[model samples]
Target: MKSIFRLLFFVIGLSLVNAQEIATTDATTPDGVGFKSKNEFYIFGDAVVIGNNILSKDDKKAFNVLQVNNDDTKMRYVDIDRDPTTFSSSQAALKLPSDFKKIVYAGLYWSATYAYEKGSRKQQKGNYVYKGSGARSKIVNQIKFSLPNQEYQDITGEVIYDGLGSPTHLINSPYVCYADVTKLLKEAEVKSGAYTVANIKATQGYLSGGSAGGWMMYVVYQSPTDNPKYISTYHGFALVNKEEPLDITFENFKSVEKGDVKTSVVVSVLEGDSDLRGDEFAIIKQRDGSFQSLSNGARFQQNFFNSSITNNSIKNRDRLPNSENTFGFDIAKLDIPNYNNTIINNSTSETTLRLKTEADRFYLYFTAFQTEIEQTYFDDIIQDNNPNASVTAYVSPEIVRAQPESDPSYNTKEKRKAYKYTKRSLNSKAFKYLKNKKSAAIAGIEGGYYVISGVFSESLRADKWTTKLIENGLDANAFINPKNNWNYIYLLRSDTAEEAFELTEELKTNYRYRDTWVLKANLD
Candidate 1:
């Protein structure tokens, strides 16, 4: 009787251990947590499946029919590079705008559903059961990563959540890990390229639900041609199904005070089916505090997690194979402000998001949100008047030119001289529009030409430089360019290009202003 009681207690304890689900938690901030920048941010990643031709072209849209772990599916390595040393690998491309100046922060994330193999299956009461004991591994957090045209390097990351360590992770046997790759990317100057991740350690055979694995890189970059934005990235492991829905609330950031506000969210999920229906992604509306389903041309409100990487209604075809359905992996960017039923606006600062499914069960590992914010400008500096000072060089010049001459050689000589001066000026400096031509609203100061001294990403730095110039008796002021959110410090503004060009040339003679250039304020 004592032995029986002991056995009962043992069973109870084991069940309790298996009942605890992995909890979602925040990753350590590589650049001080929450939202790292008020600049442009984006994400790029790919699914790491072990096999090719898993689904036929005919099964692409066969809703509720095909699955990753279907009986007829054969599991194999998805090695597009044909590297003989790696066990399994996959590649995804990353692309950023040419104007992206610097990377503020970068986080690498990789996840997989491990240990559901054919040998672990057993029949109990006419139902197949998976033990999944092989899922636990001490080296689960180690993986091989390669940048474009580079050799693979081994990297070990922090385990965000491992099902083997969770009390309730046994149901699906999953794990997610992360590493701060900001320094690596900065040193390597990785702007855009194909990234390959290998040895993810996921089972290829079959699992009770479905098999899935993937890696993602979330990056925050600074750009002189993008609006000031609040960007935040969150990482963890949680399940969303009919019985348990997930809600993630975001705060510590505010929207722009006025004008049009744009907000977006990016999500990375695993085990979502391309065919299964009933998964829903939603956000709490600020107007009514009610959940509103998010939908686009590529995603449906009732089936948001349909195993595809998308930006709004458009699908991304930047990766190798670029499969129509990633088996079960999903990464998407949803522009909330552009959605027809969106309730987010200028008044929104905090928000709550929810994910649930009635027929499909999937794991949510990563979520990121970004929104436009008011531009930060430098404070105006006061200048003291000095009677002994020389007159400013920016004064409009009087026109002085010889009248047209009858002699053909005289005209040719004048034309040649003018062309030489124009060529020399253009070759010595570069210029760009202060505002985008497509923008409807005027940007920067109300001048046709600006003699710019410097451009800065941070307003504080621009302010500091402007202060020094004012102290030195230079009539310098800074203005925010609405088109790109960059602070431009200018020494002079003129209505005519000739006046601006003359002032720029005069300033170029000074060692301190050797790089001074002209900015055309109006392209229209």
Candidate 2:
């Protein structure tokens, strides 16, 4: 099944390279999907709104469509960056926790409603008339990005969905694209700072549906103090409405059986009204498989997809202009564990998500789910507290020494007996012994002595250290010592204690591994 998926992705990649568009049958379905799982936390932010306003419940009845003649309602560029050279640029701040040690992944997504400006807009018989035809552009996937204290650089991404030529989007065509920016963020001097995105293509006139354009950045980071989690990101394009509610199913992840399970979801949508109600987000309950509506204090259960960017119940006001209503862009993170614990408990390894609206229509482009899972540990060996203690302490000197000086010529039989006695004495010292086990049988660890190079309390740090060792031409492996729950990274393994001891001394000669030590397992 894994090979089949890989082949499918390969074919999809080839097609994308040729056509540069993710083909979809209609405007209300996903053309492609991408997923990833890791032990990390994710944060996202977006910008590029021309106007901002506080939409009241009463205002929902006044506006039949989002495109109005007012200056605040018009679709234009939100040039908050104040860079005179760029055409359409906006800035958004990414404020990650200081404790987030490393960035695991970063993705940049941009979307827009395009192709409505080529038509003539006029009034006929007290009704607005639009004669424009939907069109696609070749440069829709090209964009410019700027990091803090840096200049703009060109970037091109894979087009996830392009709806310009689709039959459903005749006047208000929309498209979404994404780029993997993990390498760029990792190379940056600082991960959290103001980010600017420019050259996003979108209609800037009064089209049929409300004109909208923006760019978003999703970042996943690792912290040593954070719990082990299964983080999965999925991307697609679809429309959810009253007639056809979208249901997305998530699987292939395990959850912890004990303790408070932490799970959260992040979603990005377009064309959702801030004043409108009845747009609901629901997830199937693990207890009885019932769909429970999800909402926070700022978002009502009936209006879950209102235009805003939020983390939990807190509205993120760290962007330029900090618009109260983002016109139509919505990026939010909902805490599932805080909403209800009984629905998504320890038994939940799979669940389905449903999104529907009674009076509003919107497009869903991206969604991500993260949940706490059982932490995995290496089962290579049991940890001994006093690893440096003398092995001869357990064996009496008389038993290990030659039988007697009187036994001339050092009888080989007596020597063999003493060696056997010493081995038996060591076995009785609270140590487990095994023999002739294959390397695969013990978590890819053979029965041998290990030369440990580093020890860490966190698995993520241990993994990082092991990677650095491998990059430096050393075959490194890591395992958790169950006794103390500490991670131990080993550089070499040997079949004999003397060989392992000699290797440790040789490694200690290097300044990097000056504190290297040896661990011996009683494997016959």
Q: Candidate 2: worst 10 consecutive residues by lDDT?
A: 6-15
Model 1, residue 20: what's the lDDT?
16
**Tens digits of lDDT, candidate 2, 76-134:** 56665556665567667787764454555677888877775433467799887766644
- Residue-wise lDDT of candidate 1 within 144-236, one digit each (tens)? 888767789899998877775444555556777887776777777555888777777765654667666667777765543223454555566
Off by over 4 Å in 1: 1-74, 116-136, 165-167, 337-342, 376-524
Best by lDDT: 2
**Model 2: lDDT to the true structure:** 0.58
Model 2, backbone clash pairs (residues 3+ apart or across chains), number? 0
Q: Any residue pairs clashing in model 1, and if so which?
A: 20-167, 20-168, 38-229, 50-76, 51-76
Candidate 2 ranges with C-alpha deviation above 4 Å: 1-72, 118-123, 131-136, 337-340, 377-524
- State TM-scores per candidate: 0.60, 0.65
Minimal lDDT window, size 10, model 1: 1-10
* Count of steric clashes across candidates, in order: 5, 0
